[model samples]
Target: MKAAEPPVPGLRQPGERPAPGPADGVSVPGVATPSSTGSTPSPAGAGIRGKRNAGALLPYLLIAPAFVAIAAVFVWPLIKTVIMSFQDVGRRELWTGDPAPWVGFEQFTNILGDGEFWDVVWRTLLFMVACVVATMGIGLFLAQAMQRMTNWVRLALTGALVAAWSLPLLVATSIFRWFADSDYGVVNMVLTKYLGLDFRGHNWWLDPKQGFLMIGAVVVWGAIPFVAITLYAALTQVPKELEEAAALDGAGAAGVFRYVTWPVIKPVFQMVATLSVIWDFNVFGQVFLMRGNKPEPEYNLLGLYSYEKAFESNSFSQGAAISLITVLLLSGVAVYYLRQLLKIGEVE
Candidate 1:
């Protein structure tokens, strides 16, 4: 065979491959070129580095002021309240600028041992239950109804819900109080005129049960909007095909809801129910306002009892102790709900 021509330097022969350089790119047939987009750091790297640094620091910077404010506004007072709960803080210590005498757990002991405190606890719990049940019941009903409404009707209903939910606590309290007014109230006017139940000049607050019933009505009214809106949103997540399939499988409305609907919205329902419990358990404003900012002993919830102990009776230590107990009770409630949620999650 004739001698093959010597392969030319710096030029690739036919079917010849180029060599890779030690640097970050492949050498071409005639030249080597460095890669700009390789792993090697570049000027752009400084920008990326800066961005990463900023990304790490930005959250801290944004939250720093909020953390300081919370520490000042809430944490500091909470600490002081905790300290006061262990001491003998009263009007004497408050006004005299003197150190509060340490009573250790005496304040807690006094509060726990009081028969009236138990009464307040039972009453508060019962009211909380009533409001939560009514709120959840009506809210679920409204949400179920919304699914059957026309778009315009649903929109109008949603607007109304928003209006109800947007009412300030003070405004709602005032409205309910006006409704329950003894003489000129609309509720009494309607009952006496239409139903002729002889509710003229009746004081709902005279009986604790009746007073709590009215208070619960106000609480449930305000709360239903939130629960309904939330559950309505949750209900939107349910698969239409699944519901249709369930319906086709000889399931009725209740069966479809129980099998297809409930599982989907159960988490949101649980969350709303728990929130209602917390909100109703700590109810203060409606009760306080309905009774003209001077709720009697019969209407005393934990909040009212604590206020009565601390400010009204000038027993700051006792009030702080009661407040602490309320916190513990709420904590227990939260834990119980959490466990239930977890259990349901496992079961489902």
Candidate 2:
């Protein structure tokens, strides 16, 4: 420019730009330079990401068929039953192709208004409570006893429980019926002859109170195996170290159980109790078979009453309403237990 300034070191000449070097293409160390053709970087990570996503979804996809089958088989039938409860479904509508008229809540209202319905509800509630209490008590006792038993004894007890649990409902009911026979039954013989009691030739099912008790006994007996097995499994999960620590701290056996063991198994105990209540409340086969489908007024539970109303009395909608009520009641128990289970999960 003015007489051309002396050439300075590291300075470019006028109208001249710096040349590209090996360091010019490198924005950071260890990073590759852009391609000569100016193409974008290959998405190599995308394929790996896609593979991971597929793996994550595979378990859900595998279980989808099972969920679909259950929805089709059980859920569909249950929904149909609920819809039929709101309709006036009779023999013609059930057997023939006649359309069932929509009755709304008429069946529900009628059943609610009936004195007999309330009676059966009370009886069922009482029986369910009794059976649940008995089953839980016996089951807990057996579980604790099994925990302390020798291997052979535990094996024998477990085998007996499994065998009892495997017995068919009808078979167990029949066995109970034989045991309760008035003339030559084992119960009366044990009471009158062995125990010197005055129960000989006593017809156990003749009275409503006694009949309910007898049915409850059978329910408790059958339910104990399931409850005991479940409780035992839960008990196995509890560390023996906790019990020992509690004992070393001068806690008695009861104190140790109440403080150390109960907390660990409380969720399982609640679940077992809830299930027992539902099973006892909805028991049909045992009561129906034991009473020969002609249960006395005193012995009529909701299940038996519903069957009688639908089949014998031919009031299909009303029977369905009763069954729906039973379902709702059982659902309440299920919901409560599910909440408890969720709480346990959250705590864990």
Clash pairs (backbone) in predicted model 2: none
Q: Give residue 270's lDDT in candidate 2 (0 to 100).
A: 93
Residue 315 lDDT (model 1)? 90
Tens digit per residue, CA lDDT, model 2, 122-199: 988988888889999999999999999999999999999999998988888888888999998889999998898998
- Which prediction has the highest lDDT against the true structure? 1
Q: How many residue pairs clash in each candidate?
A: 0, 0
Against the hidden reference, what TM-scores do the models get? 0.83, 0.83
